[model samples]
Target: MNNIEKIIEIKDLKMTYGDKEVLKGINLDIYKGNIIGYIGSNGAGKSTTIKILLGLVKGYSGSVSIFGKDIENENNDYKQKIGYVPEIAKVYESLTAKEYLTFVGQIYGLSYEKCDDKARKLMRVLGIDYAYDSRLSSFSKGMKQKVVIISALLHNPDILFLDEPLSGLDANSLLLIKEILYKLKQEGKTIFYSSHIMEVVEKLSDRIILLNEGEIVADGNFEEIKDSSFDGSLEEIFNQLTGFKKHNDLSSEFVSILKEV
Candidate 1:
């Protein structure tokens, strides 16, 4: 496909904090309607990449384009076409569920009636309909997460960037969120999600990108990585490709010593 057809394009992306480089010449492209999974260990710069795409951080030395516009130059128009759900769900504690989402929709330039209708539908799907009028401070972790998801979709953006979107969700909510993601993909919405959960990535992603120490280590489908002898399961392949050794081996030795006691 041509470059302009891609929903998200990153070329030679680089970022640094002091003398430590966080992103090292990263290059990636995500097309419309595809779910791309970004997997990496802690401090691997996954979140940094997402932030740069969302224009949350600037002064990077690469080019990033979303929906056919340069993120730097596009301004609000580009931002309005994308939705973001951060790893931590932050909401106004004093506002009710409906109230909070209404506020978010307004910021996206939606009318009050449209926002209310969309918010109500999303809340129902997220199993938070009963809490529509409840204050955010009175909601559970999962409830808060649902609110965040609802807010992200209220504007009906073409691209959704989710960072650890299922971090604090319960099992039911997790399944619900996954289903919702698949539905969105069916509707031709591009989704870029990051997480440490290998199984979920394997199941949900059309393609996976492995990052290690601010570098793209592996980028391909599961079968391709396995055929290259990376390993069988996604977890095994990730560890092998990223050169991550399990610290649990040390714990095993300690447990053996305790057994002798």
Candidate 2:
């Protein structure tokens, strides 16, 4: 592991929001070309961690290094090698897909002609080229998601931070995106995939890190994690590790309550 290229490193990472401790001493190292499934329940600090790593959050206590440089050093060069898709689609509603994507590509230092050409080609490949000239406000959830994905990759980043990227995609789009991610991994791109979809995470990740109560409780490959927890599936292991095994009982109780009405 030491000989491999370490792309991201977190040491004793801690963050507090008002009185709530969001991250409680997280220590992790991400190597190049690895797809990491960073899963956790809501408010378990998964997004917070990613935000900090992306330099969007501040006042965190600990050290974070990207590309062998400390993030706190105020060096913005590392950001050029990274791309991020937020949990929410926050595209400019009034701008056409071409306009928005072209602006994004330009921000990454691409020429206007290059950005426009690449954007058009990518939109065409995704089957959304017909709407490229239309306002983003008219795009469906899936279309907007596809645009965001394209914008993030326009810079050819070495690392990708995707937070719930498959939120509103259809089956075919989802399958294609999964294939794209796999191909990206083959090309030595590190992917930090944060999602609640256990099945996708289980199948896609080279390594999985499970967070519960602001701490990593499980970290390993699928088979290793299963063996360690003595569980059958990733979902079962997630339930066991997160200490949430009452789905059946909870459902039954809810049903009984409904019957009373």
Among the numbered candidates, top lDDT falls to 2
* Error at 203, model 2, angstroms: 0.2
Quote the positional error of residue 111 for candidate 2 in Å. Answer: 1.1
Q: Write the per-residue lDDT of candidate 2 for residues 1-261, one digit (tens) a residue.
A: 788799999999999999999999999999999999999999899999999999999999999999999999957888888999999969999999999999999999899999999999999988899998999999999999999999999989999999999999999999999999999999999999999889999999999999998999999899999887466778888888888989999999999999994
lDDT of each: 0.87, 0.94
The 10-residue segment with the lowest total lDDT in model 2: 227-236
Q: TM-score of model 1 relative to the true fold?
A: 0.94
Q: Which digits, one per residue and each the tens of the lDDT, describe model 1 over residues 75-156?
A: 5678887899998878999999889999999999999999999898878877779889889999888788888988998999
> lDDT value for candidate 2?
0.94
Clashing pairs in 1: none
